[model samples]
Target chain A: MLTKRIIPCLDVKEGRTVKGVNFENIRDAGDPVELGSFYAQQGADELVFLDITATNEKRKTLRELVSRVARHINIPFTVGGGISSVEDVVALLQNGADKISVNTSAFKSPQLINELAKEFGSQCVVLAIDTRQEADGNWYVYLNGGRVKTEADCFRWAKEGVDRGAGEILLTSMNHDGTKKGFAVDITLQLASLSVPVIASGGGGTMEHFTDVFRQGKADAALAASIFHYKEIGIPALKQYLQQQGIVVRWESNENFIC
Target chain B: MNIVIIKYNAGNVQSVLYALERMGIAATVTDDHEKIRSADKVIFPGVGEASTAMQYLRERKLDQVLKDLHRPVLGICLGMQLMCAYSEENNTACIGIFEEKVRHFSAAHADVGQPAGEEPLKVPQIGWNNIFHLKTPLFRGVHENSYIYLVHSYYAALGEHTIATAHYGLDFSAALHKENFYGVQFHPEKSAAAGAQVIRNFIELVPAI
Candidate 1:
């Protein structure tokens, strides 16, 4: 059986990953290569590098950064940010990224998912959703890094993404992000109806938070940024905790730990 | 010595690379014929849809190179599927090393009410399945019915190359071995200790040049 994965996401800007509160007022974490290598060593199943900057001219920089990270990290890496066309996805894949995430572009043209999946297999395409809970309890999916709201319903878009050929769905809860309260279990469970694997992002404060998403949210993977970046919950310890909970994680002997 | 991982737009190469790193063996991923042909060992790991994967291999003329490899070659998941004669996945023709056709597990077995003769199993057979009935050095010290991680909907029925077997909707080929070529449906990289031991065994089996 495929065990649920634990992934750590890094927000990259101008070649460096930025981690901050509420996706604003960011602080430099470290070099992307170093952080990626650290997470790979710590037992992260996969790493996602989201280029936070919204621009058209920075694709080359993102590509260079991806190549650098690929040189050092051995695990699967997904790159997103400012991806508009199939060319963007190809460029990222050519540079060493295992998958490309499309958010705003997919919303602009839902057919993009189908097209990309047809051209480069569904497993290579990941649909990233930035969702916020409306006051009325309806979750509205946003784009452009949660800056703009789309009329497309969150659940509808998720199913559409899978229908269009997204191998995985990365749903980020804007409401619980950086708050440490917990993941949006209801939303996660709602999205779980689709066959594609779901990766829950945002709102992770502790190791218990991860366990909660796996147990309660029913997510295939739980991704947290600051917690892993700040050395708060190293991946090995987290795996131990999950294993104790009967999650059945693949444990590796940490021979590199020179202690 | 570097292990050459064929990069024909297949998924799970990263997983194989990480698995090798876990065993402290460094490898280089490449699609170039010269690089792959000269390497100590060649790994063709795959995931995702098969038709397009075969298309990519054909486009790069890698199918011929893969068939001609004299050194040890290891294929995992979709990689194993591609090594077969043909796949029902999009009805794609493959490298044809193994004379077997890949078929989707039908729900007929799962819907049945009989205790032994049950209904058809579900599609996209996901999660941890067990692999048993091993042959040769691949299973080396691996225990029978050892639980391994799997995430595929289609499976290769028993054929001339089947090295091991597993049951989901029914008994299916779990691993394949043919001379210098080998294939395992489970993701060795993600299979924990059993998976790592398999990888280590593959590394150890690479014939010295």
Candidate 2:
């Protein structure tokens, strides 16, 4: 069963929607193609934009705001800050973007994650780690966005970005980024114990912190940004409070509710 | 209903051409062989790497025009593992139009969510699971287990053109018909609203074929 995903990460700056508390103080959270088609009509199984103004004229308006949020959203979205090669992931997957997260040229050239998983393959490559924990618990690895710091070992560069192919692993936690006081559940269970698919990202505010980052950070996905950009929380009441706390999310329609 | 999304080199055909422009249906990604042989409906979406996507679908022969398309060809997710017939990932050879094979959910013996030392069930079986055994009409109104949106690492196992099924650590083949050729190891354009009612029941089966 693959349910536990409820992502919301929008970040984009200069074009719109922005949130940053521990990452700074930037605010304004709106209009990323209407808060990403209002979190894909509020079910939000996926969506992560983050192009914090990688300027070349705000990178052509974040590829026209990811082609108008992939033409007013259907679902599966992802696009990260200044992607850095494979023609910026084929211009944001030809202006639509399904997935393509790469943190700072993948830790400054880990062969740009095998040249974007050898040109868009490793399930459309995403290796967005941004750790930072130390004080003896050690986690280190942050780049351009988290503003540099790299001894590398954030579970050995996420097992060498999942051994150079990187199917997925968004993992944020710059000491619980934006500090809402929740996720980073022990390094998102140490990058979900490194098997692969682990999208935990920062301190999500509540909804029992996305059911403790998916039942104690076993996180197969649980990203957030200011608890869904200032609405504080409301991805259909946090997937109806993580489906009344069972946590198998992706719930919009009590029966076909798409819009 | 001209649709047409088979453009080879994988990677989610721009989210299945924005899930057919969010059902307003303005598709056409194209690999060209006569615009996908006079398309009436032909998705074959993907997310890549099956021996360089069958060497870019045999360098554009689009694998014999998607094995002589007579129309109605769904195929999402590595375009339903490159329309089966062989793919141990790089072991290649596909487009047999569903005789099945595509293994590697750790050899498909699958105990469903493997235990005895976790962390093994992650060979790309990516997001939203649960497709249950739903037999054809491309899952019309799709229910049984309903949760779609998959992202592979090679599957397809349960053959005889598996109508639909999904178990992650193993049950396999979540949707793969034969006749008018359809296939969906999930991602009915990122599964939401029961994957947009299986893309409006595959665009109302392109006006009932």
Candidate 1 chain B worst ten-residue window by lDDT: B113-122
DockQ of 1: 0.24
**Where is the poorest 10-residue window by lDDT in model 2 chain B?**
B106-115
Instruction: Please give the TM-score for the first chain of candidate 1.
Output: 0.94
RMSD of each: 4.7, 19.8
* Per-residue lDDT value at A72 in model 1: 61
TM-score of chain B of each: 0.92, 0.35
Give all candidates' CA lDDT scores.
0.79, 0.79
Q: Which stretches of candidate 2 lie over 4 Å from their true place?
A: A1-109, A128-130, A133-139, A142-169, A177-180, A183-202, A208-221, A224-236, A239-254, A257-259, B1-43, B48-55, B58-60, B63-68, B75-186, B207-209
**Tens-digit lDDT string for candidate 1 (A1-259):** 3467888898888888888665667888888889998887677777899998853343533787887786566556788888878888777766767778988878888899988888777767889998998888799988777778777689998998888888889999998887778888889988877877788998988878888888888888888888888887889999998888987664544432211
